[model samples]
Target: MLRRLLGSPAAVSGHLHRSLSTHCVSTNLRRSLSTAASSSSHPPWAIIDYNTLVDDSPSSWAPGACFDPLQPPRVSRISAPPHLLRPRERPGPGTNLVQLLTGHVTAASADGHLLLTYYDIIAEGPRASWNQTADMEVERFICNPISGQLLRLPYVSGSRKRICYHRMGLLTQPGPGGARFAVADIVSQRERVIDRFLPELGRWDMVVGLPCQPTPEREMDMNQETVAFGGRLWWVDLTCGTISLDPFSYRPELRFVHLPTGSTLTSHIHTKSESAEERDEVAKYRRVGVSEGRLRYVQTSLHEPFVLSSYVLDEEASSWALEHQVELKQVLADGGHECKNRPPQIAVLDPMNAHVVYITLGEQEHVVAVNIYQDKVIGSAPLQNRYHYLLPCVLPPSLGSSQFPETGKKGDMEAIDVLVSCGRHYKG
Candidate 1:
């Protein structure tokens, strides 16, 4: 029947014309899908760059997943900057330059609020006189990228400085009224004390009497990603394990959960010997996250015959049970790439899919999503830089623009009150 329709000269001409029109439309559509493509059509989950942002276009500042399904994941150069209420003013006609570095996404709440610290530097007069005229101010705040609401946090208790240098985590606890928010600070390196800043209270409360260090010899170093899971804030060390405590508790006790045996650096590597650079290299291959309603850990072997392994935490046994282990040689081959001597860094685990993981491969740092269960590469994207720290934020249907409630108004008051008390005027 199909052949009969095309057998006639008139029918053949009509079909060819339609095919040509369809091809043109598809070509134009592909051309329009650039980095600034409409984000409403993309998935909610995105690998957000910690320090990158596009300040000109306020709407595009929210990180939206941008990658072509047919092509390897391509880096979108114009990333959504953290939407700010008070943008910096342009430099005057004189030799003046105001540079703003958005800094890094230090931590994130499971609900999607990001804890960011940035520096605003202004230099006036002339290029040569920058040393004398430059003024830099540090700003730390939490914001919901989806909602575009930001709240600058008050200074640490009794500190004259505007920014706190300690490791911080965004805390969210669901309550009968609503989810209460706060920031948890590991106040001391040698002690288990924490300073939690409650927006409602408008002050930082010092939390003490927590458990001591898990390993007295191995000092606690929490420079890795902080995970908010199971009603506690987990401070992870890629080389060792995690120490977690509930910020909401009046008298919270710290608990230690070590990485699965053979997964971490040897017990004898003291804090002094294991430098920050060494710890960072270790983190490139290993990651711990909450996926599929379970705390999971993933590690890619540093040696040849490279292996990618995953384990899930068994709270009952206080250990990680092996879930999946697959050699990368076959996986890379399937992805139309070759396995190199060095394994790809583990980018992120799919918060919604238990079997999917993203790994950055090659010097170009193409991000490839592989399904460990199937041992196949599902998707790939190229990143602008290999050093970008990705923070995964899964936005569920329930998440909306009004995620910030009346409590945000109180937070604003707290910010102003602190500035007044310190005799410092609010910059913005």
Candidate 2:
């Protein structure tokens, strides 16, 4: 009876045989799973990537992975005076745990803890004039911060013009055979369209029905940052509407939803003719992000004390509602010097903890966390100025390899090579 319930060895290994026959396991999957199964028997660690600004040194632009941000010190359970509990010290400038390749990190998979970066290599010498278009070769790569495994992705054919403006995102999950992952991107210029990379097929597939047209008068652009929430990928337009796509569907679907009336992010925009400087000034004060599985909008004013207004998307009502409105003075008592020059760039680092938000202050590039619910500053860390240009991604804890097969026989290796080389393409 026990043998029947558990199945014989042949029956137990049948699934593995089928996976080998189908050639579903990829090189990345094999490497990641094997490494995880052999490594220390501990939970996977969570980390974040901090992409620095341009620097003369070739290596300075690489991302710095940090593990300390999410692991706050724990308090003792033993009874004691509150004052006796030592406060947790903030991370210093030298706390970066790992340094990755130099490139523009375009997307991050919070679930898988993977990073996608785009690097442009000038094939020819410098052009004589800035207006002259030079030969540019673009390369895309995805890397695992924990394992330091990097894979070069095949080039996707399209207009290279304004490639820097393109947006990318990653999604991953365990499949019947092994782990599967997909990378998606949106390029908008002449026409708006979506492209996704399917690992199983090893090719790019385009999804239609995206509302890419921007009114001639507005000339709006899609925000470069993307959020993967509730099984859909979301992108916010500069004009205040969101574009969502379901990548896993048989025929991917795209939808756009407008922001609520009073919660419109453009409340501060002025229609009157103004100098280029004034227009750029207003653009610096607004940001869009996701928090607690909902879309969030943050807007700040140019005046003193920097009043910040935050809004949350009310999914059921199909609208946004004002969530928090707090002045910088109320939170950061000193009102750091950077506040006077420009508004801080805001990002919701911990969506699970809706109260905390990450903000980047001026030239100094001090990354600080503020608690909206408590109405106080929580932590502060000095970010190197060189890493300021890249977007900050909050990666969740690693999903260790223990979930996959611990070992594969020689036959499995042969099968994977044959399958990968054939370049079989599968459509969702």
* Clash totals in order: 9, 3
**Winning model by lDDT:** 1
lDDT (Cα, tens digit) per residue for candidate 1, span 199-291: 667777887757753543465666456788887788877767887778877777777778888866776654566544455567778888878
Residues 322-389, candidate 2: write the lDDT tens digits: 88878775467653434645666553344556676666667536666777677777777665322222
Model 1 lDDT at residue 5? 17
Candidate 2 residue pairs in clash (backbone atoms < 3 Å): 52-387, 53-386, 53-387
Which residue segments of model 2 deviate by more than 4 Å? Answer: 1-102, 123-131, 158-165, 188-192, 209-219, 260-284, 334-338, 390-394, 402-428
lDDT of 1: 0.57
In model 1, which regions exceed 4 Å deviation?
1-44, 54-99, 121-136, 158-162, 175-178, 212-217, 267-275, 407-428
Worst 10 residues of 2 by lDDT: 11-20
Indicate the worst ten consecutive residues by lDDT in candidate 1. Answer: 12-21
